[model samples]
Target: MKPAKDWHAAPLPADEAKRLRQLRSLALLDTPQEEVFDRVTRVAAELLQAPIALVSLVDEHRQWFKSRVGLDVCETARDVSFCAHAVHSESLLLVEDAHADARFAGNPLVTGAPHIRFYAGVPLRSSGGLVLGTLCAIDTRPRKLTPAKQAALCDLAATVEREIVQREAARETLEVQEVERRKLRVSESRFHTIFQRTPTGKAIVGLDGRFVEVNPKLCEITGYSADELMHMTFQEITVGADLPADLELVAELLDGRRTTYSFEKRYRRRDGGTVWIDLSVALIHDDEGKPMHFVSTMQDISGRKHSEEVLRGYRQELERRVLERTRELTSSRTALQTITDNLPVLIAHVDADLRYRFNNQVYRDVFGVEPSSLHGTTVRETIGAAAFEHCLPYFARVLAGERVAHEGIVYEGAPNRMWNATYVPEFQRGEVAGFYIMSQDITETKQRENQMRSEVMLDALTGLPNRRALAEQLALSIDAARDAEVPFALFFMDLDGFKNVNDQHGHDAGDALLRQVAARLKKTTRADDLVCRLAGDEFVLLARGITSTSACSRIAQDICRAIARPFEVGQSEARLGTSVGIAMCAGGTQTSAEAILAEADRAMYEAKRKGRNGFRFASLLAEVAPAINNLVDRGSATRH
Candidate 1:
């Protein structure tokens, strides 16, 4: 054995501190003996017929044996270890005779018992480029190791490295899984609470439509006990007119053609009265994606339905009095017709069959038809197919004793006009007999509203999406990416030397340059990619479905090159470059839009720091040093 004094006097490698950290990260030092490591050492010793073999991890003060054969001691002083020198080399270190070597001539290990003579060790390097220790073979007799033996030792060391890396990876995977499991447990707990307390009539129904489970609200809505509802199928309670449609939707769900559906339907309560409900139903699936059951939420809308009926009745009574007065003043028909013909709004009455029973002169003027010709014509024939389809659903609701009002476009004249149309049901003997239609032009109002909305969402100078629009789109993109599990990259770009343009060439010229830059960015990116003017001299690009960092870098490069081209502003040409920072989220990573934007912003500044006109990916900065270095070198070359 070597003297303890000499062991403390041995010089440490330059990377000794870093290597010790890497060794500790493996967590193999002073660990219990593992059969896997022991097997490797045993095989290595048998191959070389060495008296001793060890898998040694060099720590700050000691060389610890993770696995050893023909060795009673667990550790030795680091300075006295042959493996210490091996850890400093990238390849195998061999000594045919330690006694003859100058470094070991006065060493106690060579001069004392268990005399060291021959030694061969291969450095075990970590993925981070730090050599943690060595896989070594030792012998008391002075003998040289052949080329084959040296190669074998290196191979064994590589195996040891692989084992350590694999173990670390396995541990990390287990930790991630544990975190996920805990989150799932919390989510399930919250879901259970909401499912039990939600006020909506929630129920779980079997594929056959029989109630498998029902909440308290469902029982109250249906006026049935839980036991009563469980014994009945959903089709049994549904109104006859709505049953067929509901059954078709349920069939679609079972066949996997649709996962969820919503519709307005009527159901018969236990008391034999009809209740209107807005029903939303979804199918739950098993692990294999087989349909398991239907989850349904029903909200009662009977009060709203009743209010509509009451409003329809009052309107119908008013229409009846007006018709009676018109009949009574028939003797003054010419005066009445003259007054109505001069009015701007269109007025008409349609019977339950949708046939026009009456129409004023203004209605004829709007449709470009004679007043007499439209009296007996159906609305569909008078308005054309597209408009008829648009009005049909509201008409049906009107005929169902509901007052309906909606806005629509009419394209009959030289210019298209928008109209606010109201349909009031004419009730007779507690049923809808006909309906009166009133339409008022609102084209200018609609146009102004649309213009205001556009102004709010668009950048006034560049005509690109403004910050508000970018935020909205970014939110949508994040949701879509999460749902589809697709990767996307967000780039935060700032224009370099833009302030100089404003200083040298006036603000108008600066604005012009910005508009040109926006156009260039739009032209250089894909149609689906969103490029927005975030603020003055700043823009953002959201690139979807990126395959890799290389692709994202290419996009940034394209933008840089496009913006670098000279811009013509009135009498002068302006030049500016773009610096970009990219933040990426792969599929299934839960990251917010704001988080990604912040990350990209930080990276953008990093690019600017490394001399502008380049892009840097946030993830690669810490994990891939070589790639980052290469990017910097390439960027410098491009600048030159």
Candidate 2:
């Protein structure tokens, strides 16, 4: 205790004192006794051998005890405490005795409870030169301190300052650690949310390949429960074929070659089917930068895989078919070219514009040009307008889908060659793409045609000339038949019940039966006989100059037997019979060979009406014809 001059009065700068009070107010004053505070107080008390020691904080109104040994309740009023004076003074304050020193003689602490008589206090300074407070010791009896003890106390106060600094550093470190811990908690929450909510399956894996975490999506993809998956390694669930590749990718991630790796793999389900998955793997590192675990994301890609495979197969198949078609088309094109080149007839094709699109070698040769030069050349340009006009009407009719056929001579360009030409329409996509023209050089055919026209008599079935060569012949019959006249057969026969045959069987069967009969008749006839298929199985035979009727009868009877045979019509058996009518010019009264053929045709029907399968005489038809068309032209009359 001391008698103080006005307590706030001090020799320090007013602002410095205010700042020092602020510094001291920041809890250098009267704190709870702890190791940091007590260590300094205890050392000072022991070295000084005083009854009490204190590290005090002096505020404007009170001296507060920061650390004290042997002091009670931690504080005293500023007016009564000697340490308050030590705080304002930069140097030490010492009082030998309050009773003996007039300055503290009237202090209540010396006259009242826990009276202090001897006191010494040294000012404690902060690093900023603020007087924080004092390190002071007290005695109930007047005492003196040794110099060493005094110095030791000052050193102990400096140690307390250093302890405050160290304690502050510890507190800052604890706050930093707390903040880091909170960040870790937030990051963990975020990671968990992402793992569960992502569309793909995600997992953490141990180095031993066990799952540390497997999301619901992972469970679904693998077709395993979470509990089941937890007991199995990824190797056991992955398809065997995909395991090796997966291992390689995992190795890359674990080796730090990549932080993340991705690949497509298959996972085998419990039912033994496999699901395709796209896997992305990443390595997680520990604080020390060592591999801690693997994190993987799996995406189901079965649909995509199947689509790609199917599309790839379709593409490959389409390419194969395309190649096959191209090869076939090429072969067909080459064959068509060969056939066209070798054909004797001229062939040409023209487009919508009447320009030659394609033409055979004959056409090119007839026009006196290379085949290639004819392409895209109009008929008028290539052959002059006169030839084009002659062909234009046929072209127009063909373009209108009308089939135009004409047999007349026309002179082509280049050497004035004449041809009998015909044009056909070629359709594409239901429209006429072009015209196809064929022409034959008829310069020699015309001569043959003229010679054929001179002989008016012809085989009724085959439309070839028949044996009118006898009377119309200016030479011997045999020579006239062979060279002077194109003598052919007029075989006269009747189909027995030909009407009933058509009725009993269907028309299709009857027609088929007739065609078969005609084929057999053609086979039986002479190769040069000109076998004619007449209507309703009535055939004529001009057995020209037969050596005898016996030979002709044998031939006719053989044909009759041939017609009596069985035939197979579709799904049924059929039988046919015939009657023969013999007609020949072997010195008969008929003047011309036509008279004999007319008689035989009439006699054949008569044999059919008479009990069939029997031959009849020519006199019967001559008798019937007079009543029928009266101009029967009996000039070459029939003789019976």
Candidate 3:
């Protein structure tokens, strides 16, 4: 058994003991071998003209050799080793002969191993005067060390101390690095969790345009599997025509010129369709401050793009029509004649007797007469009395010197198509000369106008009826409900936790999620049901003819589940749960449409307060309840 550690083996000051502990904590007392130490020991041995030189670490009960130039063993017991006592000395410990030295005369190592005869060692001390170990040179022959040789030996030991400090510093740095690596690993796991499951597309792109990392949403949006997208360039999935001229922006980022860029661009969907995406890109720089690569977020904007296109078309059409009308009104008579003759507008003249006089080719052809025959013919003579009866009042007003202008009526003598006509009484010297008729073939125009009016009532983003159209539908529905004495439910729904996606991802992703929510609502509701968008994430559903509160509640649950389904947008999967408000008409109660809509909206807010992703049916019960019951019931039934 080794003797108990001698805490008071020597008289040492408090500061010196503290520093000695620090030096010991460096863990160099018993260490492995290395070339820097070996070289030092080798040089020390050669300079001292000794057979052996050692860099030794002294522990409590043993001395461990870090490097021994002429010795084969790595360590020895403290009872036999000279370095064990050398560590206690502040300076060199010289033993001229271990045989004569009482401390080693009975040591088994000195008698058996390469016998250490002449020994000199210097303490390896820290800056604070803590002796950790020794660097000693050994010789086989008994000899005394010279003063200069002793000094050189001390310097060499000091060099060893410096090496120990450098090693300790390097070890501490390695430990710190290991701790940082562990933290980075945990952070990377968290990042993966967010990247793989987030609701928006995310990617790390190389300077060469290759994707270093891509989220699942990106895989879904591009129609390629996640494995496939990872090996591809961003350009591979990008539609070439839609690629921006500033693709060099990525290069600039790599060259340290820019930090971030965002743009609207198109990507080729897996199904070979084009999907519009708004991309936000940021450059990642290395430690040297050179841009290494880029990280980007992609959001789907196909619906918004479609809405923008429709709005642009409407604006352009309005502008074009305004310009065309301006030109027609400002041009000369010859130009007018040319336009009227070539265009679908019908133009002609009638005399005070309602006779077809000056007429364009269309008028001549419609009247089935030459200009000579129709010039002086009366309406009764040219078109027959039946046609004459339709326009006699207008002609009488013109003949009485009153100018007439109206739409929705036209009269042609021979072959007249259904036309919308405007009649103006031409004046001559302050008296009515004859009627100048301008008619247009507006059959296609009327059809298109009606179509546009219907479309304007629908939400372009969701394909649901918009608020304007909902008002009309509600009014009509209310009338039918009143007549039949039947009650209907009005449900207002708002998605839960939807704002976070907008904040973290972007507006484009938010819009896409809204569209998906709209689709889910449509799918969950009955086909006959009318769902309307009240703008900005608000929806109103009229369960056109519901039976009871329970029935309406069932529909609301369905909606909640439908919305809760993962929304795979771009490169991310997001869950936008719903909070629904339900208000059922009292089956026969007389209430305004506005009142019902407001009640539904209020209830929806109540649902939001009771924790989102839930439903609140309008009072009999105003108190909030745990939504778990409803979710469980819904889950069981809908699972099939």
Displacement of the residue 274 alpha carbon in candidate 2, Å: 1.7
Evaluated against the true structure, the overall lDDT of model 2 is 0.66
Top candidate on TM-score is 1
lDDT of 2 by residue, 392-428 (tens): 7887999898756555646446444466665667678
Across 357-421, the per-residue lDDT of candidate 1 in tens digits comes to 77779766677888778878898887777778888899999999998877765734414788867
Q: Write the per-residue lDDT of candidate 3 for residues 507-576, one digit (tens) a residue.
A: 9988888888888788888898998889888888987778666687678878887888889878988878
Q: Which residue pairs collide in model 3, if any?
A: 217-570, 217-571, 217-572, 218-571
Clashing pairs in 2: 490-540, 490-541, 490-542, 491-539, 491-540, 491-541, 492-539, 492-540, 492-541, 493-539
RMSD of each: 14.7, 58.2, 28.7
**Runs off by more than 4 Å, candidate 3:** 1-344, 348-359, 363-402, 408-420, 424-436, 441-488, 524-530, 543-554, 585-589, 606-616, 619-640
- Which segments of candidate 1 are over 4 A away from where they belong? 1-336, 409-415, 483-489, 504-509, 526-529, 543-551, 568-574, 584-590, 620-640
Please give the lDDT score at residue 10 for candidate 2. Answer: 30
Backbone-clash count (model 3): 4
Better of 1 and 3 by lDDT: 1
Cα-based lDDT for every prediction: 0.79, 0.66, 0.71
lDDT of 3: 0.71
User: What ranking emerges by TM-score with the best candidate at the front?
Assistant: 1, 3, 2
